[model samples]
Target: MGALLVVILALVVGGCVCVVWADRGGPRWTRVVAAATVGSGRVLRRYQKSQRREVGGGADGDGD
Candidate 1:
Protein backbone atom coordinates (compact mmCIF):
# COMPACT_ATOMS: atom_id res chain seq x y z
CA MET A 1 0.00 0.00 0.00
CA GLY A 2 2.75 2.40 0.92
CA ALA A 3 4.67 1.71 -2.28
CA LEU A 4 1.57 2.28 -4.34
CA LEU A 5 0.95 5.56 -2.61
CA VAL A 6 4.51 6.68 -3.33
CA VAL A 7 4.21 5.79 -6.99
CA ILE A 8 0.93 7.68 -7.29
CA LEU A 9 2.47 10.74 -5.67
CA ALA A 10 5.48 10.57 -7.97
CA LEU A 11 3.30 10.46 -11.04
CA VAL A 12 1.25 13.44 -9.93
CA VAL A 13 4.38 15.47 -9.29
CA GLY A 14 5.83 14.48 -12.63
CA GLY A 15 2.67 15.51 -14.42
CA CYS A 16 2.75 18.90 -12.72
CA VAL A 17 6.36 19.38 -13.80
CA CYS A 18 5.46 18.53 -17.37
CA VAL A 19 2.65 21.06 -17.24
CA VAL A 20 5.07 23.77 -16.20
CA TRP A 21 7.54 22.77 -18.86
CA ALA A 22 4.88 22.84 -21.54
CA ASP A 23 3.83 26.29 -20.47
CA ARG A 24 7.42 27.32 -21.15
CA GLY A 25 7.18 25.99 -24.73
CA GLY A 26 8.01 22.35 -24.32
CA PRO A 27 7.34 19.70 -27.01
CA ARG A 28 3.92 18.85 -28.44
CA TRP A 29 3.53 15.73 -26.33
CA THR A 30 4.24 17.75 -23.20
CA ARG A 31 1.44 20.08 -24.20
CA VAL A 32 -1.01 17.18 -24.15
CA VAL A 33 0.22 16.10 -20.75
CA ALA A 34 -0.07 19.67 -19.54
CA ALA A 35 -3.71 19.94 -20.56
CA ALA A 36 -4.59 16.76 -18.75
CA THR A 37 -2.65 17.88 -15.70
CA VAL A 38 -4.44 21.21 -15.55
CA GLY A 39 -7.83 19.61 -15.96
CA SER A 40 -7.16 17.11 -13.23
CA GLY A 41 -5.92 19.89 -10.94
CA ARG A 42 -9.13 21.82 -11.43
CA VAL A 43 -11.20 18.76 -10.60
CA LEU A 44 -9.15 18.02 -7.49
CA ARG A 45 -9.44 21.62 -6.30
CA ARG A 46 -13.21 21.57 -6.70
CA TYR A 47 -13.52 18.29 -4.87
CA GLN A 48 -11.35 19.50 -2.01
CA LYS A 49 -13.36 22.70 -1.67
CA SER A 50 -16.59 20.72 -1.51
CA GLN A 51 -15.17 18.42 1.13
CA ARG A 52 -14.08 21.39 3.23
CA ARG A 53 -17.50 22.97 2.94
CA GLU A 54 -19.15 19.81 4.17
CA VAL A 55 -16.84 19.47 7.14
CA GLY A 56 -16.92 23.15 8.03
CA GLY A 57 -20.68 23.60 7.74
CA GLY A 58 -20.19 25.90 4.75
CA ALA A 59 -18.81 28.73 6.83
CA ASP A 60 -15.68 29.65 8.73
CA GLY A 61 -17.57 32.05 11.02
CA ASP A 62 -14.53 34.21 11.64
CA GLY A 63 -16.26 37.34 10.40
CA ASP A 64 -14.11 37.72 7.35
Candidate 2:
Protein backbone atom coordinates (compact mmCIF):
# COMPACT_ATOMS: atom_id res chain seq x y z
CA MET A 1 0.00 0.00 0.00
CA GLY A 2 2.75 2.41 0.86
CA ALA A 3 4.50 1.57 -2.40
CA LEU A 4 1.29 2.27 -4.30
CA LEU A 5 0.96 5.63 -2.58
CA VAL A 6 4.54 6.48 -3.47
CA VAL A 7 3.98 5.59 -7.11
CA ILE A 8 0.87 7.71 -7.27
CA LEU A 9 2.68 10.63 -5.70
CA ALA A 10 5.52 10.21 -8.15
CA LEU A 11 3.16 10.20 -11.12
CA VAL A 12 1.39 13.34 -9.91
CA VAL A 13 4.70 15.12 -9.31
CA GLY A 14 6.01 14.02 -12.70
CA GLY A 15 2.87 15.18 -14.41
CA CYS A 16 3.20 18.62 -12.79
CA VAL A 17 6.78 18.84 -14.01
CA CYS A 18 5.66 17.92 -17.51
CA VAL A 19 3.05 20.66 -17.41
CA VAL A 20 5.71 23.25 -16.65
CA TRP A 21 8.02 21.89 -19.29
CA ALA A 22 5.24 21.81 -21.86
CA ASP A 23 4.34 25.42 -21.15
CA ARG A 24 7.96 26.35 -21.89
CA GLY A 25 8.16 24.16 -25.01
CA GLY A 26 9.21 20.61 -24.27
CA PRO A 27 8.80 17.26 -25.95
CA ARG A 28 5.56 16.35 -27.73
CA TRP A 29 4.81 13.72 -25.08
CA THR A 30 5.16 16.36 -22.41
CA ARG A 31 2.50 18.44 -24.14
CA VAL A 32 0.05 15.56 -23.98
CA VAL A 33 0.78 14.98 -20.32
CA ALA A 34 0.49 18.67 -19.60
CA ALA A 35 -2.87 18.93 -21.31
CA ALA A 36 -4.14 15.95 -19.35
CA THR A 37 -2.80 17.42 -16.12
CA VAL A 38 -4.48 20.75 -16.77
CA GLY A 39 -7.78 19.19 -17.75
CA SER A 40 -7.80 17.00 -14.66
CA GLY A 41 -6.96 19.98 -12.49
CA ARG A 42 -9.91 21.86 -13.90
CA VAL A 43 -12.24 18.91 -13.32
CA LEU A 44 -10.95 18.52 -9.78
CA ARG A 45 -11.54 22.19 -9.07
CA ARG A 46 -15.09 21.96 -10.39
CA TYR A 47 -15.78 18.87 -8.31
CA GLN A 48 -14.45 20.56 -5.17
CA LYS A 49 -16.56 23.62 -5.79
CA SER A 50 -19.67 21.49 -6.17
CA GLN A 51 -18.86 19.61 -2.99
CA ARG A 52 -18.46 22.88 -1.12
CA ARG A 53 -21.81 24.05 -2.39
CA GLU A 54 -23.41 20.90 -1.06
CA VAL A 55 -21.96 21.55 2.39
CA GLY A 56 -22.59 24.93 4.05
CA GLY A 57 -22.35 26.85 0.76
CA GLY A 58 -24.40 29.86 1.85
CA ALA A 59 -23.47 33.02 3.69
CA ASP A 60 -26.96 33.89 4.94
CA GLY A 61 -27.61 30.31 6.04
CA ASP A 62 -30.31 29.86 3.43
CA GLY A 63 -29.27 26.94 1.27
CA ASP A 64 -31.41 24.17 -0.03
Candidate 3:
Protein backbone atom coordinates (compact mmCIF):
# COMPACT_ATOMS: atom_id res chain seq x y z
CA MET A 1 0.00 0.00 0.00
CA GLY A 2 2.88 2.40 0.71
CA ALA A 3 4.43 1.81 -2.69
CA LEU A 4 1.08 2.40 -4.38
CA LEU A 5 0.65 5.72 -2.59
CA VAL A 6 4.15 6.80 -3.67
CA VAL A 7 3.39 5.96 -7.29
CA ILE A 8 0.10 7.93 -7.18
CA LEU A 9 1.84 10.95 -5.67
CA ALA A 10 4.50 10.88 -8.36
CA LEU A 11 1.86 10.75 -11.09
CA VAL A 12 -0.02 13.72 -9.63
CA VAL A 13 3.17 15.81 -9.40
CA GLY A 14 4.11 14.95 -12.99
CA GLY A 15 0.66 16.05 -14.20
CA CYS A 16 0.98 19.38 -12.38
CA VAL A 17 4.40 20.01 -13.94
CA CYS A 18 3.00 19.31 -17.42
CA VAL A 19 0.09 21.73 -16.84
CA VAL A 20 2.47 24.52 -15.80
CA TRP A 21 4.74 23.92 -18.75
CA ALA A 22 1.80 24.05 -21.21
CA ASP A 23 0.40 27.22 -19.58
CA ARG A 24 3.84 28.75 -20.28
CA GLY A 25 3.27 28.17 -24.02
CA GLY A 26 4.77 24.68 -24.43
CA PRO A 27 6.13 25.27 -27.99
CA ARG A 28 3.70 27.38 -30.05
CA TRP A 29 4.81 31.03 -30.43
CA THR A 30 2.36 32.00 -33.19
CA ARG A 31 0.58 34.54 -30.97
CA VAL A 32 3.68 36.69 -30.31
CA VAL A 33 5.21 36.18 -33.76
CA ALA A 34 5.20 39.03 -36.28
CA ALA A 35 3.00 39.30 -39.41
CA ALA A 36 6.06 38.82 -41.60
CA THR A 37 4.88 35.29 -42.31
CA VAL A 38 1.92 36.54 -44.34
CA GLY A 39 3.96 39.31 -45.99
CA SER A 40 6.74 36.93 -47.06
CA GLY A 41 4.26 34.45 -48.51
CA ARG A 42 2.88 37.17 -50.79
CA VAL A 43 6.41 38.21 -51.84
CA LEU A 44 7.23 34.58 -52.72
CA ARG A 45 4.08 34.26 -54.83
CA ARG A 46 4.95 37.40 -56.80
CA TYR A 47 8.52 36.19 -57.41
CA GLN A 48 7.26 32.88 -58.77
CA LYS A 49 4.79 34.62 -61.11
CA SER A 50 7.51 36.97 -62.45
CA GLN A 51 9.71 33.99 -63.38
CA ARG A 52 6.97 32.43 -65.55
CA ARG A 53 6.88 33.13 -69.36
CA GLU A 54 3.85 34.73 -71.06
CA VAL A 55 1.63 32.72 -73.40
CA GLY A 56 2.48 34.86 -76.49
CA GLY A 57 6.19 34.93 -75.75
CA GLY A 58 8.44 32.30 -77.40
CA ALA A 59 12.06 31.15 -76.91
CA ASP A 60 12.88 31.56 -80.64
CA GLY A 61 14.02 34.94 -82.04
CA ASP A 62 11.46 34.66 -84.92
CA GLY A 63 7.64 35.09 -84.70
CA ASP A 64 6.87 33.29 -88.08
lDDT of each: 0.89, 0.88, 0.55
User: For model 3, how does the per-residue alpha-carbon lDDT over 4-58 read when each residue is reduced to its tens digit?
Assistant: 9999788556555555555677645432232334455578776765554354354
Model 2 Cα shift for residue 9 (angstroms): 0.8
Give each model's clash number. 0, 0, 0
Q: Which stretches of candidate 1 lie above 4 Å from their native place?
A: 61-64
lDDT ranking from best candidate downward: 1, 2, 3
| Residue 33's lDDT in candidate 3 | 31
- In candidate 1 the C-alpha lDDT for residue 27 amounts to 98
lDDT of 2 at 58: 43
Best by TM-score: 2
- Please tell me which model should have the higher lDDT, number 1 or number 2: 1
How does model 2 fare in lDDT? Answer: 0.88
Highest lDDT model number: 1
Order by TM-score, highest first: 2, 1, 3
* lDDT score for residue 25 of model 1: 99
lDDT for model 3 comes to 0.55
Give per-residue CA lDDT, model 2, range 1-64, as digits (tens).
Answer: 9999999999899999999999999999999999999999999987877787778554535453
